[model samples]
Target: MGKATGFLEFDRLSEQNIPPHERVKNYKEFVLHLTDEEAKVQGARCMDCGIPFCNNGCPVNNIIPDWNDLVYRQNWEEAIKVLHSTNNFPEFTGRICPAPCEAACTLNINSDAVGIKSIEHAIIDKAWELGLVKPQVADKKTGKKIAIVGSGPAGLAAAQQLARAGHDVDLMEKNDRIGGLLRYGIPDFKMEKSHIDRRMEQMAAEGVNFLTNHNVGENIHPDDLIKDYDAVILSGGAEWPRDLPVPGRELDGVHFAMDFLPSQNKVVAGDKLSEQILATDKHVVVIGGGDTGSDCVGTSNRHGAKSVTQFELMPQPPEKENKSMVWPYWPLKLRTSSSHEEGCDRDWSVATKELIGDNGVVKELVASRVEWKDGKMAEIPNSEFRIKADLVLLAMGFVSPQQSILEKFGVDKDARGNVKADTEGKKAYFTSRDKVFAAGDMRRGQSLVVWAIREGRQCAHAVDEYLMGSTSLPR
Candidate 1:
């Protein structure tokens, strides 16, 4: 431990943000990182408990205590090393991850947990500033080839690991650019695309080839991958956004959150659009309260929306969790994201009845209060109301992986329509076809970026073992 009573002496501190008015003026990151002294104090808050539940809570199993101590001692180079030992992209996670590790901290029982995420942010930012992060190309060649479908977090992680193991790795993306969601789904204001570009450069230096605009299933055949590579790993994300098939669904202003968010990201990327889907000077209603919904709120604010409202089908969760009961586990509690703080009218226990429009453009949304009975949601008859909404973005979440790619591979699918792979037992990550494996959202359905990284790392080990009968890579 850095100090005997460090946990007792220091309190948790989060990163500061720019004023909402200032941030909404442009598309750029707004979080102001802690200074070195502040970061050290935050790091000192780690108890360094004998059994660190934070490790278990982290999907990537980062050595949280070790890095905390390292940063507390101002040993930033070592801190970065420890951080990178498990997570390949601390910058990405530091910016976007919800930090379940903090919830699972031993200190969280009484005192606040150490500022693990902020410490991580400081370490990575310092590493970048000092030019400490670099590519590590293999010294010896294994001469084995691997093809990874999808260039999202999962595919990138797997590709990097396999490339470092001396295997020839090709990371393929169906999109016009490399990053699947990271490049498009996420707004630049949350995490700029430069982060992805820098990592891509490092991966290229490490001998991992990236092929953009390659729709492996539609344009390139599954047979092509099998013939060219020893193994194929499917890491394509779960797309297929859940939809509302109510009355007036085909209205001009009603759109999917994915369709709405990506276009703004494209515009931020300097793409000029003749007729963009915008919320400017309009009343925007975002359906479904989640990260995507929060993102929509933020984007609409940026577009200068007249007003913004978000709806949650389920009732609102308690502001504070029952820590006694949910200790060391992620609890159900209200989470107000940065987007929510920007400005939003949030409603819970709401169900949309239909989109009300005139001349094929959305004018308002018809909705009603919902009550749960026997685990089923039913709209209350007399609680119906109409809210002005010039644009309606559906942020309900994804249903499954895109069926076209799954169909092309002819892989078995589970009842949820996710790619069928034994993620447990002896045949974990193995698809129905020989020499084919699936991971990330393709197998697990819609999930956090941390979960995707975990699956990617594990899938790499599975693939390595399948090829060489053993693997040094950590699962």
Candidate 2:
């Protein structure tokens, strides 16, 4: 341990964020990272417990304590090595991930947890500045070709691993550009696209081919991939968004969050729109309270929305978790994101009855207060109200993987409509179709970027085993 009593002597410190007013003026990263000495102190807060639950809490199973000590001792080069061992992109996770590892920290029992995420952020940013990260090209050629369907974190992870293992890897994306959600779904303000671009450059150097504007099931045939590649990995994400079937759902301004988010991202990337879907000078109501909803709020603010409000069907969680009961596990608590602080009216236990509009353009939302009785929600009879809303975004989350592509492969799906694949036991990650494997959101449904990376890494190992009989890649 860096210091035996570091945990007792030090308190936790989080990274600062740019003022909401200043940040909303443009699309750029707002979080100000910790200075080197501050980061060291935060790293010192890690107890380096004998059994680090933080490791277990991390979906990528990052060696948390080891890296914490490395950073605390200012062994930055080694810290980056340890961070990269499990996670392919710490910069992505550092900004977007909720940091379940901090919640699961041994020190969080009665005090603030170690600032693991910030430490990771500092290490990676420093590594890049020092030109420490580079492509690791394969020394020998396996001559076997592999096709990865999707260019998100999962597909990128699998493609990089397989390519380094001497397989010719092709990462395919249906979109006009690569990075899938990373390139489009996420706003540049949260994490700039340059991070993805730099990694893509490195992957290219490692001999991974990226084919954008290539829709596998539509443009390219499934049979063609089967005939050409030795094996195929389906990392296409769960994209079928959940919808509200309320009255007036067909209104012009009522749209899914995905429908709205991507356009703004494109605009930020310098794409001029003929008819932009904007929330500017309008009352915006974002349904569902989660990361996607928060993102909508932030984007709407950037668009100079007249007003923004978010709705959550469930009641607000406790401000502080009962640590004795929830320690070492992610707790249910109120999470006020940076977007929320940027000026948003948040309402809980609310349900939208319908979109009230005139001439097919949304004017307001008819909503009602709701109460859960016996685990089922019911609208209160006298609590109905109308709220002005020119733009209504349904950020209620995704339902399943798009059926068209999954149907094209004829892969079996579970009751939840996710690809049927065991994450454990002998046939892990293998789909019902031979030589076809699935991972990430396609298999596990909508999830965090960290979980996607983990599944991608593990699925790569499974695919490697199927190809070589025995594999050296870590699961």
Candidate 3:
């Protein structure tokens, strides 16, 4: 610990944000990172707790206390070194990850947890400004070729690690751009696409080939990759969105959150789409109470929607958790995102009964209050209600990856339809098919970006070992 009594002397300092009224007018990041001194104070709050559960709490197992001590000592270069040693994309995690590490912090048992995410953001931004982030080009080539499908966090991490291990890596994306989900699934208002572009540039300098518009199952056959490359890794996301199967779901104005979100991201990137699903001057209803739903709220507000309302099928969680019972683990609690803070009418324990439409466009939503007992749901008697809705966005999360891709590769699938692959033991990340591997959402179903990165790094380590009969890459 940098300062033994620093936790007692300092109070938590939160990052600032642009006022909702002002930020809603445009699609750009509004949350401001902490200043150097503010970050220093926040970092100093890390206690001498003997054990750092935050490391285990993070999906990528970030060395939180070490970086906190470095930041407190103003060792900016070393802070990023420690950060990058574990996380390949701190900028992404620092901006959008839910920060489970904070929930597991020892200080969180009674006091506020240290702002580890904010410190990470500061360190990465400082590292970039100081030209400390650069390509780690390999000195010798391994004379092996590998193909990684999907350019999401997992694929990106795997490609970079394999490239650095002296292998020829081709990172492929089905879309016209890289960053499978990060390119479109996320809103630019939360994180600009420039961060992804910058990392791609660094990766290109490291000798990882970028192949866009390369749909494996559609245009590029699995046989070609199996024949041309020494090994193939599937890292695509869980793209099969869960649908609301009620009547009138065929209405024109109703769409999946993914279909609506990507259009805006493409427009922001200067791509001209002939038609966009806009929320302007319309009564918008977003179904589901997750990050995707919150993103819809934010984008609707930016589109100048007449009114925005969100619905959740589950009951609302408590505003605070009983830390004694849930210490060192993630707890279920009420979470209000920045988008919710901007402007949104949120309701829980409500289920949609049907969608009322006119002229093939959605016009109203019929829903009812429900109660849960013994993990079963029952609608309340005579609690049906109707709400005006011109546009309905379903953000209820994804169910699994596209089965077509897995079928084309002839790889075994789990019961949940994700590519069947283990994370430990001798056959780690290896699919039933010869020389084929899977990681991230493609193997583990839908999950956080940090977890995806962790799987990618571990999968790369496994692949390198399989190819060379041994590996020096970190797991």
Q: Count the backbone clashes (under 3 Å) in each candidate.
A: 0, 0, 0
Q: Each prediction's Cα lDDT score?
A: 0.92, 0.92, 0.96
What TM-score do all the candidates reach, one by one?
0.98, 0.99, 0.99
For residues 1-475, could you state the per-residue lDDT of candidate 1 as single tens digits?
A: 7875888887778899999999999999999888999999988888858999999999999999999999889999999999998998998899999899999999998778778888899999999999999998998888899999999999989999889888999999988788888888889889999999999999999999999888988889998898889999999999999999999999999999999999998888898888789999999999999999999999999999999999999999999988899989998999999899999999999999989889999898999999999989988879999999999999999999999888888899999999999777668899998889999999999998888888898899899888988889888
> Model 3: runs farther than 4 Å from truth?
none
Query: How does candidate 2 score on lDDT?
Result: 0.92
Model 2 agreement with the true structure over 1-475: per-residue lDDT tens digits: 8887999998888899889989999999999888889988988888958999999999999999998899889998899999999999999999899999999998888888889999999999989988999999999978889999998999999998898888999999999889988998999999999999999999999999999998999999998998899999999899999999998899999999999999998888888888778999999999999999999999999999999999999988899999999889999999999999999999999999988889988898999999998999988889999999999999999999999899999999999999999999779999999889999999999999999999999999999888988888887
Model 2 lDDT, residue 383, Cα: 100
Two-way TM-score contest, 2 vs 3, winner: 3
lDDT: the better of candidates 2 and 3: 3
Error of 1 at 154 (Å): 0.2
